[model samples]
Target: MSHSVEVYAPQNWTVEQWNFVVWSEGAPSNTFGRSYATADWLLTQTAVRPLVGIVCGSGLGGLADLLKDQVAFNYRDIPNFPQSTVHGHAGRLVFGTLKGRPCVCMQGRFHLYEGYPIQKITLPMRIFKLMGVETVILTNAAGGLNQDYKVGDIMIIKDHLNMPGFAGNNPLAGPNDERFGVRFPCMSDAYDRELQQLAVDVGTELGYRDFLREGVYCVLGGPSFETIAECRMLHKLGADAVGMSTVHEVIVARHCGMRVFALSLITNQAVMDYDSEEKANHEEVLQTGKQRAEQLERLVSTMVTRIEYNNNYS
Candidate 1:
């Protein structure tokens, strides 16, 4: 999951090199530039400056509605923004207050499976960093890969195995913009440990002691679910939850020195040991995601409040 830093010579340019610039046609001088421009427009429209950014996963758009003094911006209205075309996802940006902290929420997100490039998929995270968001809470709907994982459980992502990154596809692959981050960024602990413990403590206080689990998330690029062999391989590689998104954004966030906390809503089992003719589908994923939305909302809201208070007064 590491990128090699090689100096590019124009005469030695490969087709891949040409495609890299083509893929990132008008990405600002840096991600922060693009983000700040968008945030300026958003601030003008809403009069709120977001300190934290939350990206909503499948069937979880309702979390954005809970924000007070909310201002909405459709993805179509943003320049160079790709629209999310998946079911169970609402493509909008919401600015408002949650737990007395000004926050921004992406009610929907773009995925690599949606025919977007890596840089395009991670555009929102860059914007969040530019807009002064120091921390990010990313949520997703994923299939449980661990044998003990059950339906409707909430698993906190501790680390991730990025298959896309391993395959030479990375959001930070193109150019080394020292203005945004270092050429080689270390990712020893992608998810913030303190924020994770806060989530665990919050869940416990809310009587979710037994249901909250923490483990590694394996990220792959997919619109289609995994095959049995793929599930087995992922399990062998130490993943508790497997999904299509999050890892790319986490990398972008970390590159910009933003703390990240991620959670996965276990929508269905990975179908590794299933014998019934019944299969998993998006409908079930959406249903389970909705079922657990309320608890997720409570946990994230409390965590945000605590983070703001601790950072300001502690």
Candidate 2:
């Protein structure tokens, strides 16, 4: 690191803010200013004022395809946005209506293993907040840790175990920006209970009971899959599923006072037995997602329509 480079931080910036700007590749420390810039640019590109924001997970880019009258921007074209380098992520920010409600969906999302700073990983949530998104729906591909969970099951995230946060890499680690939320945000009720129930009701109506289940998801910083021992430990610790993303985004969205609902598509059962020949791989994750893509899309699209009528979020 060079000691001679003195970067300019906006007036009244805190030390934590300065550190994030100097370290975060995208300089996402300016929660209000930088996010507002992206939001303003997006507004200029499309007239849609999204009330709900959706994040598409691995092998789930099809979620964006459901948007009607779509307008989209590549991550590179979006100011201060980090590009998605991983395969399976289309890396676009799509805006349109879902069931007649204006919405924006991330065709792909960022992850810790992508090498972005923690702040950069959660920058899109702030951008979504600035874009008039009141409710957020996030989806991801996860390895089921629960022995009873099947590969094609869809787990409604009722809670999460943030392995990264436990290691001091939380997205909210930087200076507290009142413009975003309180210095110490309450996360005990992070996943909105009402939204969870709404999803349950919708899933039942759609006859998805066999595959729809609710459980705790655990997020790990990963490009590599979890070890057998690690999988066993996480399951014992109460995480029904494990994944590499979604937790950070959910934290940021909730920090900014957005109603959050998350879903995990169990793409593969975690390799919990050392003697078992099953090797956890990315190809299998996408393949399973391909098989269940239509059902996942239907579940979300139906829930989106009813979200407006749900008095809790409205």
lDDT of each: 0.82, 0.87
* Model number with the top TM-score: 2
**lDDT tens readout by residue for model 1, 1-314:** 00111111234656565445435657545444455455545656776778889999999888898899998889999865679999988899999999789899999888999999898899888677656677899999999999898998999999999999998999999777765678788898778889999999999999987789999999999988998889999999999999999999999889877889999999998888656565779999999987889998998898899884224210
TM-score of each: 0.88, 0.90
Worst 10-residue lDDT window, candidate 1: 1-10
- Give the Cα-based TM-score of candidate 2 against the true structure: 0.90
Candidate 1 residue-wise lDDT at 302: 85
List the pairs of residues colliding in candidate 1: none
Scanning candidate 2 in windows of ten residues, the lowest lDDT window is 1-10
**Residue-level error in angstroms, candidate 2, position 88:** 0.7
Candidate with maximal lDDT: 2
lDDT for model 2, please.
Answer: 0.87
